[model samples]
Target: MTGLIETNETEAEAARKAEADAAARKRVADARKDADELAARIKVDGPRIVGELLSLARECAKQSLIAKALNAELPEGETPVPQADIVARDFGAEPRKDIRSRDVELWVVADDGRIVGDQAAVTSSDGITGHLHVAGAGLRWRCARRKFREVEFNPRTFTDWPGSFHELIRLPRLDGPGALFDGSLLTIEAAAALDVAASVKPTKRQPRPVQIELIPVDPTWPPATAAAPTEADANS
Candidate 1:
């Protein structure tokens, strides 16, 4: 009777050990599957994730700069004043998709109440080709002509090729033009004319375009005076 009891106890111990081993093997296989799935996801989405993070950082830096400028211009004991009333509009399609094949018209205005006429500044979404035609009399037209001439008709200062990854165009500031023009209008024009092309080749997956907000900087905030350039000065 004692021998038989020992044999049964040993058999039971072996069964428990086998069950544990089988569970361990299953757990290992499941872990490996999960790891492989994660690796595949990262491989597919890594570039887009990195691009989004970079864009977020760029936007944050821009906001920080704007805040610093506002703080610096505020009076010592005065509350900060809002410069412009921002109006948000919702376009169903993404800006890149909407603006990609379209030409944009901008109404550039000056503080002196001068406006760019119907033959306004028109630019392609890509910023590669555009015409700056400001019709009307006075300092605004002259300033625009001079600036365009200086840049040889191309306002695009910097661009990342193979696609519109990033671009910078130098436009005359309100203060630079003797405060005759509104800085807000220039900002709007720049925002509208910005390039959004991601690639030259047609791909099913288009890269996300950079988003630009129309934030007007107050030309009067810092309080600097610039005399309007004379005809001779403009010509020279």
Candidate 2:
């Protein structure tokens, strides 16, 4: 009789628990339905307001990230300042790709709002090359492509080839002209027209990859097919 009584009590408890769960589920469903009805009442403004709020949140997050990355703050008594000129680079160490720019700022001064020279002082990206004027340094020139070799000119030897020597200097597939550097620089036209053999000096330690000499531009010789000039050729 006691076992029967206990079983009846357990069944009653389970029934009550099931009823409670159903009520809780019904409340959740009703709450979701009410939210949907409320959203439907202000269909247009609701979406726009939500979108704007999300955008504002995103902007706040972005500013937070920028502050963390830069660790920036205004000095005491100074107002916040915005910069128009900003450049992006690879953020971390061990960068593989190098950032290259021909239009570079050569000089800058920050005291008392003073700045000198315009961007035009440097050559434009259009074909024209600019050379640096470095005192007492040999000018290094490279072929625009990975061709047979590079050419270096001694100071003040960059001039038109007079074709005085018997040997010929040949540079194949010339890709415009490169920069020339000396205490006083020369323009690209002046540098390209340089007498290669006269300007290039034989180095004692470094082996010359390609020997150059000046030969008369002959109709008999094929165009762009000249070899390195020998001692006999030079003597001739």
Candidate 3:
């Protein structure tokens, strides 16, 4: 009967609509899941982001006349000898060495509403979440100076994996007082934290795996210049 046929067609159309709705919901859920994994990866390797800031500062100092002037003013980390008004004899003397610093820290802020200090996660390990909450939180470093920089953690997190950056930066020094990608005499601790982050394998977790090796890039500066500034008088 015609009535029976109409009912069957209506049922078929309803089924198709249901399937399409389900697919759309699935896609949205998947996108949200991807965003979440990305956020976790960023949280783990955030330290390197701080290191990059330090590197940029070093590059700035290396290229600026102000830096050379400051270097001259500060001198090497060696002790300074007191210039005696009258010398007992015209003999030569060794200058005292200035104290050298191989340790420092800095700050890192995630942009684009990508990450927040919010959303604490409970790890599989017991109270591991609390440990992370304490250790992982805050700016990794407080400050950095000279071509010297330092990174926390016993082993290089980025080089080791499961802890590294998911973002690359081509940000200029103008972005912040200390924002560049190169520094002369950068310490290995910070180097591993920065460049190493973008080269490690993903943690590959369920639901969504953490993907790293994504970094901010500035191709303008050659690789050689990446570790330091380029100028006629780079040391200055």
Candidate 4:
């Protein structure tokens, strides 16, 4: 009888332990899921918020300077008016011309972890994975995971492509120079290959998606023969 009682108690304890372990695992999984969701949100929204704030702050600073200058006399005849007055005088002197950019999308190919050229690539209509659409000023780039959070391109390192489609990009980081997001800028013609209907909206035309493939360079790759940099390199 005592043996039977002991066996029942042991089984109950084992069951309790199993339940505790399952609960612990569940909690850990939940935490990881939450963290991933937050990370995705940050990646998508972080850049846009930062850019808007920077722009807003700049506008505020200019307005404040102009307000202060308006109350002060313009310093006598070229004696160097306060910086504020100079800026304020120029603020609306000329008509503000809006700069329009044609939205272009392209796939940047990568070779051995570097962007080889600025020419964009034509993408097929299949599902896009391991690829992203990047768009920005002529050669400068701004890539977003979703919206607002833009990745800035550094011109110096990217111009070193030697025919292979590989180049390095500087992503935003709290620490200086985030890891290289390597890829190419598709040539202008690749814009025709974009999924236009998927990108358009009923109320507005969306910015074209330029898929950028971020691949880190392998420190282990063999070195190549030395050669002169091309025109693109010099221009970049």
Better of 1 and 4 by lDDT: 4
Estimate TM-scores for all models: 0.31, 0.20, 0.28, 0.33
The whole-model lDDT of each prediction reads 0.43, 0.41, 0.44, 0.44
Q: Rate residue 162 of model 1 by lDDT.
A: 24
Per-residue lDDT tens digits of candidate 3, residues 115-201? 224334312243211222336566332211122254333332221221112123333332224434443334423443444333232
How many clashes show up per model? Answer: 2, 5, 18, 22
Superposed Cα deviation of residue 136, candidate 2 (Å): 99
Root mean square deviation (Cα) for candidate 1? 38.4
Better of 2 and 3 by lDDT: 3
Q: What is the C-alpha lDDT profile of model 1 across 1-236, one tens digit per residue?
A: 99999999999999999999999999999999999998776556643554453343334334444655788888789875422211111122222222123334333332332334653354335533334444464323321211121112323233222211112222222112222212233343343342323311123555779998987586564446767669999899
RMSD per model, one decimal: 38.4, 41.4, 33.7, 37.4
Best of the two (1, 2) by lDDT = 1
Better of 2 and 3 by TM-score: 3
Residues 1-236 of candidate 2 have per-residue lDDT tens digits of: 99999999999999999999999999999999999888675554543453343333334334434544454665677644421111111122332343442433332222222222442333324323333222367742211111122233333322233321111212211112332123124333343344443332222355659988988877675555878789999999
Cα deviation at 40, candidate 1, in Å, is 2.3
- Give the local distance difference test score of model 2: 0.41
TM-score computed on alpha carbons, candidate 4 = 0.33
Candidate 2 residue spans exceeding 4 A from truth: 44-236
